[model samples]
Target: MSDLVTLGQRIRHFRTAAGLTLDQLGDRVGVAGSQLSLMENGRREPRVTLLTSIATELGVTLAELLDTTPPTPRAALEIELERAQRSPHYTGLGLPVVRAGRSMPDDVLESLVGLHRALLERERQAIATPEEARRANTAQRLHMRTLDNYLPDIEELAQQVVRESGHTSGALTHREVGLMAQKLGFELVYVNDLPHSARSVTDLDNGRIYLPPASIPGGHGLRSMALQAIAHRLLGHEVPTSYAEFLRQRLEINYFAAACLMPREQSVAFLSQAKADRNIAVEDFRDAFGVTHEAAALRFTNLATSHLDLTVHFLRVGNDGAVYKAYENDGLRLPVDVTGSTEGQLVCRKWSSRAAFARTNRTTEYYQYTDTPEGTFWESTQIGTSASDEFSITVGVPFADSKWFRGRDTANRHRSTCPDPSCCKRPDGDLAGRWRGKVWTSAKLHAHILSPLPSGTFPGVDDLELYRFLETHAADTEG
Candidate 1:
C-alpha cells in the first residue's frame, strides 16, 4: 500500500488505541475534526507540522506512523495479478479474463501465485545490481569495524582448536596440519582442476577437503587454506544466512587459521622478543612465521592491541591506488568517502601507502614518515604479488612508538596535508595561481574496487550451493 495510506491507517489505529476520537485528537493538536477525518481517510496529505502534532497527540513517532513494509511474496503476487487483470494490455491478451469481483478457484489462484512468485524470484536474482552489492559490502565492513575487527569467542575457539591439535607453542607446520586433518577424520584431496578463484572446498558428507594442486607445494598458503576448512568443521560454523554473518564467519575462520599457523603464546613470545629488538619489521615477523607479509601484518593487528598494548594501523593498497583493506586503532585518519567507508578510497600520494607504488623494487620495503593533521605516523610498506595483482601492504605506528621499529631513522620523510587542497605541502598552489581557472584533474574511477566479494552469502561460495551441500550432508548422516 502507499505510504500515505499506511500513515493514515496507522494514525487511525493509534487514535483508537489512545481512546481518543477524531475530534479529541484534533482538539489536542489544534486541528479541525473534519481535517483530521480527511487525513485519516487518506483523502488529504498532512503537512509536516500537522503530522508531528498528531503524532505527539497520539504518543507515536512520525516514523512509526509513516512506516510501510512491502507486502509478503504471495501478497505481492496477488496485488500484481490484480493490477494486471485491470490493465488494458493484460485484458487485451484474450486469455481467461480475471474480472474485478469475479471469483476464481482457490487451487488455480494458488498455482498462478506460485508461478508468479518463482518468476519474481528469478527476476530479482538476475537483476541484482552493483549498487546493492556495494551496500552489502559496506554494511559488512561497518559491522566488522564496529567489533573492532576482533572476536573474543572466535579467539577462544581458535585456542581450543590449537590445544586439540596437540601443538600449543611454536610455528605450526604443514605436516602437523595434515596430521591434524587426518586426526579429525578428513582426507586431503589435491586436484589440478579446481577453479583459480576457489582456494579450497570441503565436502562434509564425503569427509574430504579439496585443494588446488598449486596450493599444496609446501607453502603457508596451502596450510592456511586447509586450516580454514578444518576450522569450519571444528568450530561448527554453519552456512551464514546473510552477508554480514557470512563475512563474520569468514573472519572467524581466518582468525582460526592464523592462530593455527602462529599459535598465540608462541607469537606473543616472538613479538615480545622482536619488540625488545631496536629494529622491528613486519618482514622479520613473516620470516619468523614462514607466512606471507600480509598474513603476518594481519596477525600483528590481532595481538598488537590486546597483548602488546600498542595501537597500530594496517593498510593493503592496490597498485591502482585504491585501499583494499584497512584497520586502525590509532588516531590516524584514513581516507574515506562521504559515507565513512575506507575501502575504495584513494590514498594520499604523500602517504607511504601510495608512495610505495613508485618504488622500483617490489620486494624491498619502503618507509615513510608523514605528518598529518592528527599527528606524525611512521609507516613501513612492502610490495608483493598475488595471483591476481600486485599490491602494497603497510603497518604503521604512532610517532611515539616508532622508536622500536626499523626504518624509523630513515631520511624518507614527507609532510602530507591530505583531503585538503590548500595544505602547505601541496606544490600546486603556485601553478594554480599562475594558471587561474585552467587546471583540472579528473578523478580516476577504479571499477575493481566496486566489485563484490563473491556470489555466496559467505565470502567465497554461493549461498544456495552452500545450503544445498549442507542439506545433502544432513540427509546422508540421517540415512
Candidate 2:
C-alpha cells in the first residue's frame, strides 16, 4: 500500500488504460480537470514540473513514477538526519514541503505530496482576469519608459566586482556585494519605503515595486515595503507611465524565478563544483535551490549576471518600499542612501583591498547602497563602530562614480580603512546625533562610466529635475 499509494494506483492504471478522461487526461497535460482528478486520486502531488507534464502525457518516465518497491536500508544516522532535516538546505519548502506529516518517509511523503497537490491544483487553474490584470498592468508601464529595453545586467555585475577587486580600499556587504552580483548575471530587490499613499506618482502609475516594513526595517524590510504598498494600491493617486512597467513585469517575475530556481547552466555547474576552500553557503544555496534563506539570498544575487566577470547588487529593496537599486559600470549616473540599518544588523567594512579579504570573509553583506567611505552605510550609525548593534547593515564598494567623488573621497581618506569611522571624519554635530538612523538604509551604485561626462551625454528626467525635486521632497517629508 505505499509506493506513494502505489503511485496513486499507477496513475489510475494508466488513465483507465489509455482510454483517458480526467477531461481527456487534463487536455493532454496542460492540466486542470480538477487537477487531473487530484493526480489520479492519491489526492494531489505533481509539480516536478507538473510531474514532467503528467509524465509526458502519460507515456511515463520520471524514473517510471519513482521506480516502486525498494524501501528498507534505513538508519545511516537516521538517514543522514532525515536528509539534513529534509533539506531545501534546512527547509525553505522543498522535498514536497519536507514530506508533510513527518516520521519521515510515508512513501516518499506520498510521492512528494502528490506532486505538491498536483501543481497547486494546476496553479489554481491559471489565474488572471480583472481585465487580465488591467491589461497586464498597462503593458508593464510602457516597457519601463523604453529604458533601453533592459540590460544593466545588474550594472554589469557591480562593475565586475570593482574591476576584479583591483581595490576601492575597505568596507563591504549587501550580502557580500550581492554574492559578487550573483556570480555575474543579475537580479536583486530590497525595498524599505514609498507608500504612505504615494503623492505625485508616475513611473506610469507605479505598476509595482515596493518595500515597506512600517515603511523599512525587517521581515526583509517588510517584503520590500509590501511590494510598494501593493504598487500603491494598484496605482490610484498618480505617478503613471505605468509605474516603470509595473516594475518591469515584477522584475520579470523575479528574473524568471531566478531562472527556474537556479538553472543558469545548472547554477554555473553547481557553483563550479565547490572547493576553492568553499564559500558559496546561504546554507549551500539552500540545498541546491529548493529555496528561502530569503530565496537563497535571491538565488545567490542572480548569480551575478552569469559572470561578465560577475556582479549584482540589491544591497536592499527599492521603488518605494524604502528605496535601493545600485549597480556600477556603463550606467554611471550613481546615487546611494539607505541609512538606518536596524533589523538583524551586520555592517562589516572593506569593498576593495586589504586584498578585498577574498570577497568578504565569514560572508553575509548587503548594504543596497547610499554612499560610503563610512558616511553612508545608513549614515554610519554616527560611526560608533562594532556596527552599532541591533542587527545593523551598512557596507560599500565602487570608489568612483560621483558625489563630487564621494565628497572628495570623504575628505582625502581621513585615516583610510574608511568604510565609515563616525561618518569618515565626524562633525555636523556628530552626524546630527547619529541621525536616528532612518532613510530606511538607502541604496544605489551600478556605475561603470559611459557618461557622467566623457561627453557621450547623459542626465535625463530633465537633468535630474532638481535632484528629482529634492528626492521627491525627502520622500514626502519622511512619509
lDDT per residue as tens, model 1, 36-153: 8877655689999988988888898887777664223333334456544444434566678552122655566667666645644443343324454445556766665555556677
Put down candidate 2 lDDT per residue, 1-479, tens digits, no spaces.
23444455566556666778788778777767887665544456667877776667778787776655322223122223333344333365444433232276656655544554454334323323233233343344234324422334533433344345342322222343333333333223333433333321222222222222232322332323232333233323222222233345456535443443344545556555542323434446445654434444445445533442223232232211121222222222223224222111222333211112233332433212244433332111101112222112122223331221112223312123333545333447766678655447645432211112111001112323433543653464358
**Over 4 Å off in model 2, which ranges?**
1-395, 400-412, 416-479
| TM-score computed on alpha carbons, candidate 1 | 0.66
Predict model 2's lDDT versus the native.
0.37
Model 1 steric clash pairs:
456-461
Runs with alpha carbons beyond 4 Å of true place in candidate 1: 1-148, 168-170, 214-218, 422-445, 453-479
- Taking all chains together, each candidate's TM-score versus the true structure is 0.66, 0.21
